[model samples]
Target: MTEEKRIPMATIGFTTEDAREAARDSFYLDELDRQAEIASNSIFHAIMRGRETKNPHDPRVWGALQNTLFATICIARLLKPGPVREYPGLTKQQSQKYADERGEKLRKMLDVEDDCHILDVKAVRDAYEHYDEFFDRHLRDVS
Candidate 1:
């Protein structure tokens, strides 16, 4: 058998604890999605059966128009988590790994040198600094 060299792989920045934390977050998000979908489907089914339009803006037949507000909220939460990513349960290793991968992708995305006068190293640095702001801005504010 020939000996083969293997590269040392860096962790994705998630510890077992971090993985658990992420898993919890993921579970909550999934549950939120499920509940929202179910409510939407119910409203859709009701409107279909009723076959009456309360308002042009109102999709449902003559139900309390206010209920639509709750439905809209569920839909919004499904799309965006609001500002709730605050608080704790965040891990440094996990954060670092996310930052590294995000940085790498942003760096690799630059096709030309000095597109922003960024050398490869500078590119990674720029990407690193930009990632959080980019992520935050892109983060769904309503959902």
Candidate 2:
């Protein structure tokens, strides 16, 4: 009888964990994009309905507006890196220094308008992370 032929399994290039992680990352990125699009659509609908009814305080309008802001904050968080420390371990000066350096790098990369710099987005993310304190401290300057 002829010897039986043997075949080896082929490598598809990625390990199992690597493939899983890649799939998770893709899902996360896609979800973020989906949420951003929904928020943008909500904003348009809210404004249009408010204008038509001449009632800016309508519940749907207000709810949609709030969701839009929340989604914007989420997008900002996704764009920038997370804080180095979760707790308040760093001094105010050190925190500011870190933010400045990061902001500059982001600005150079984005090349966006001055008002919409990464630093501004980072500030919003910080507020969401520490809402009460940050709001009180920089309410006027948050714009």
Best by lDDT: 2
- Find the 10 residues in a row with the least total lDDT in model 2: 78-87
Report the C-alpha lDDT of model 2 over 1-143, residue by residue, as the tens digit.
99999983433346598786556555546656776797789899888878878665698887787677677766555444345443277786677666555545444444634556532555555555686875688786766
Candidate 1 structure lDDT:
0.48
Q: Which stretches of candidate 1 lie over 4 Å from their true place?
A: 1-15, 52-68, 81-143
Cα deviation of 52 in candidate 2 (Å)? 1.2
Q: Count clashes in each candidate, considering only residues at least 3 apart in sequence or on different chains.
A: 6, 0
What C-alpha lDDT, on a 0 to 100 scale, does residue 87 get in candidate 1? Answer: 32
lDDT of 1 by residue, 1-143 (tens): 99999984433346688786566555545555565566567667666756664455654542432343345454343333223332355576655555444334333443322233212233343455477887888895949
Error of 2 at 15 (Å): 3.6
lDDT of each: 0.48, 0.63
TM accuracy, model 1? 0.32
Candidate 1: deviation at residue 124, Å? 42
